[model samples]
Target: MDVIGGKWKALILWELENYGVRRFGELRRGLPGVSEKMLIQQLRELEEDGIVTREVYREVPPRVEYQLTELGTALNRALEPLGDWGRDRIERIGANRVHPVTT
Candidate 1:
């Protein structure tokens, strides 16, 4: 739970899995609600956990992109069923949105 815990981690993995390699700005743009600091921290932790790879290129402006490692790919695949379950629950909850009167 620790490795892929929190609001941002799973979303981050989803973006990389769907989009392939992405730069810092691309990640920020993809995840609209995430702040810069939170994104940086999440990426660092993911990298440290060997879930993502960060590559830097030398240039006038430094370029860095992140992609999932092999282990990360496997983990993401494992989570696909969880995603489907969550989506089903979301639909069910939405259908049952009417609340009962409380005493």
Candidate 2:
């Protein structure tokens, strides 16, 4: 939970799960509004948490790609229902205009 708690972590994992393998630039492009620094930080954290595997290709430009590990895939599955529930809740609340104040 700690690893996937970040704002962009789950989204990143979902992207990887859907896309299979993706380069850093690709991920950055896919997730608009995520700064490069934040993307790097989140990717590093995910890698450290054993949720993502980063592979580097020994090429002239040094190609790199990220993919979800087995653990990450399992986590993704677990979070899917939560995501659906959240979306449904948000839609319901939006329709009702139930805006809770935060302090």
Candidate 3:
């Protein structure tokens, strides 16, 4: 869970799940405001955790792409409920100016 316990990880996973496989540059472009260094670190961590697969093409410029593994896909599915809950909460908060109390 630690691997996915960051602000960017879930967003990254969601983008990957929706977009299928993506190149490093493409992922970076998809996620605005994410630094290149942070993206690299997160991708490395995900790859090391066996949740994301990184493929390197033996080309002149060395193309690379990242995709989620089966485990990662399952994890995303598990997080769907939480994601929906968050979306609903956001919508409710938008509808009602009353701020939600934080514990």
Candidate 4:
């Protein structure tokens, strides 16, 4: 869990896995609630962990994109069952959220 245990890490992985290569801005837009700083931090962490690859293109504006490494893809595959359990959990407990939390 150390590598992909953060709040936004798994979602980031899921997004990249499902959508393929993504630029920083595209990743920000794809994940609706993530702030710019958080996204950058998460991406850097993922890259350092060898779960993501960052490609830099020298151009007029300097284009950069991120994709999963082979290890990352395999990790994502391993997360499939966890994702399924989360979805099932949501369905199972969705009704419990009918009331807003007071705190």
Candidate 3 residue-wise lDDT, 8-90, digit = tens:
89988998999999999999999999999999999999999988999999999999999999989998999999999999988
- Reference-based TM-score, model 3: 0.91
Better of 2 and 3 by TM-score: 3
Question: Compared to the true structure, candidate 1 yields what TM-score?
Answer: 0.91
Residue 29 miss distance in model 4 (angstroms): 0.4
Candidate 1 lDDT by residue in tens digits, 1-103: 9999999999999999999999999999999999999999999999999999999999769999999999899999999999999999888777777653356
lDDT of all the models against the reference?
0.96, 0.93, 0.92, 0.94
Q: Lowest-lDDT window of 10 residues in candidate 1?
A: 94-103
Report the CA-based lDDT of candidate 1 relative to the real structure: 0.96
TM-score of each predicted structure versus truth: 0.91, 0.87, 0.91, 0.89
> Considering TM-score, which of the candidate structures 2 and 4 is the better prediction for this target?
4
Clashes of each: 0, 0, 0, 0
